[model samples]
Target: MKVLIVDDNQKALVIAKARLGKEELDVLCASSGKDCLEMVRKTTPDLILLDLDMPDMSGFEVCKILKSDNDLSMIPIIFLTATDDTTNRINGLDLGAVDYVTKPFDPFELRARVRAALRTKQLQDQLAELNRNLEDRVEQRTVEINQLLNQKDAFINQLSHDLRTPLTPLVALLPMVLKKIEDTEIKKILDLAIKNVGYMKNLTEKTLQLAQLNSSRLQLKMEKVDLKDEIIDTLDSLSSIFSEHGVKIVNNINSPIQVEIDKVLIKELVHNLISNSVKYMKDEGGITIDGFQNSKDVRISITDTGIGMTHDQLNHIFEEFYKADNARHDRSSSGLGLSICKRIIEKHGGSIYAESQGVNEGTTVHFTIPL
Candidate 1:
């Protein structure tokens, strides 16, 4: 450790330097407070032994100036006094002195105090270095995570594109081929092929959409839209499915509720929730689409008389590819529907959750949209 001894008396400086030098420390001597400050500016010492009485400036004043500087404030200062005066010791300490050493210093006491001060400074420096290293590591890890996510999104997009390229031709030609065929067995096989192709197309589209929703690349196109009209439009689009399942949709939202939202995403949200409800329902049941205006946002609920889920099932309902008892084996369900709905609502700065009593009861899905 480097130690600087500042004293107006040349004899005192020499004596102090000789005593501390024996302890394997680099001892630098200054004849006055001004010289001490000047030397400190040139080379910062780890510890300072300042004489209380000086010709150029008092040790208290020099201490105050050093402590005020952010760069030099951390260097420990020890006041060297001729007498054990209580007031002087307190004033020196208040000015940021680490400890006080009486004049005609004892070699043992001086060396011990200097070691203690240097040890504390070493620990503080170590801690600051650790904090800086931690910050760098956290920043590096964040960049790595972001890169990995981008690569994953790109792979999903490319795969979806590749799958759709071949399915497109089959989707269009298989239906026409089935229509022209007269043989019953041949027509049945072509129809089945068309259905499977259609399923693949749907799966590709949903997977691409889900991947986009999960990534940071997707941006919401916000606009003011009528909530009732959006819900009505979604119901119209899925009208055939509801009819096929013999399910009734009761639109209970009467008011023209206006909300700032991404129109396409909100429509998809309603479509997925409503379609999912019908899928799990019995042959004939009712789906109630209800909404109410609250202070901060609008709350909508889709209640269905379906084969209700248990508490555990409701907990994982929004997870991607998570299927309940019936949906687990049901090929018709891609299981990404509700997961997309959840992402849509969250992107709109809203929340979504489900409530189900138990099996053979019912399920209600609640979602919110900000005003």
Candidate 2:
């Protein structure tokens, strides 16, 4: 590789060339900064060995010019100096020299520094090239993956439509048959199967909704929604479960706060929170739904006096497929509810967080959506 040695000191330049020459480097010498610039313009070298003190312009000036010029910026420059002062060393380094060698320098150390700089430059070049290639490959793969995903989504939509068309008749017939059945045990079994089938349909619908939300195909119909009403509706939907568990619902939503949000998505968000509360609450425990409007955000909190979470559980509650240790024991949940809630809140320029003192100490899930 080509190397330009720039220094007014002929002895220093000769010694540097002699030491670096043993490695068979193509060394060119310049006695001043002006000559160094001319030499660089004439032939761009891979590296430059520069002297801090020069009769004409100093090495620092040359380094500054070289660094500022787009054409010369990539070439590494190493400074050779006699001064041991901290300021001069910092100034030299800040001017973009890769390494500073103090004089009268050890020849071996100088050679080692040069070799190390060259190796670093080579590695950097390789890394940059690899990154460019990797990026191109990644972009191409992303396009291909997206194409495949679109095809898969189309297939799923078609399959769901076709399956539901046939299932509609069976779903309608099941209830009629159950109504006429004389055996109570058989009728009960059929009813449970029908209920489970309904649950399956709900899961499929939720899955489709999640996919649409992920693909940015789900357009939210935003409107000024009364948060209090939304919370009440969600609570009403979970009334049966709450009653079954002997849990009391407390509404502290004072002074109805209106926030611009998609009613459907907000309903889902509230439903998930309330459902979770109901699922985890101890027998006869109470759940409170509260809302208030701050200056630029409306904050809603669902506080459940239930089998609360640990600090670690609270930290990961919103992660997809992340159920608390206690919740995992049931294994009945898909664990997508809180994750979906997080996505919905974030899509509306909001944030959600879970807080707990500790296990069995109750937990509060708070979310804020901008008004």
- State which candidate has the highest TM-score: 1
Off-target runs (Cα >4 Å) in candidate 1 are 52-70, 79-107, 221-263, 289-299, 348-350, 368-371
Q: Which ten residues in a row have the lowest lDDT in candidate 1?
A: 325-334
Candidate 2 error regions (>4 Å): 7-16, 30-35, 38-43, 51-58, 80-90, 100-113, 119-152, 168-200, 213-226, 232-250, 256-260, 271-288, 292-371
The TM-score measured for candidate 2 stands at 0.61
The candidate that achieves the highest lDDT relative to the unseen native structure:
1
lDDT of 1 by residue, 1-371 (tens): 78999999989988888888878988998888899999999889999999999876999989999999999999999999999899999998888899999988899999898989889989988998999999999999999988998889879878887988888789888888888889999988887777777777777787888888988878899998899999999999999999999999899999999999999999989888888888788999999989999789999999999999899998999998898876676657777888999999999999999998998798999999988
> In candidate 2, which residue pairs clash?
none
Candidate 1 lDDT at 348 equals 96
* lDDT values for all models: 0.90, 0.85
Candidate 2 positional error at 297, Å: 7.5
**Which residue pairs show collisions in model 1?**
none
How does each model score on TM-score? 0.81, 0.61
TM-score of 1: 0.81
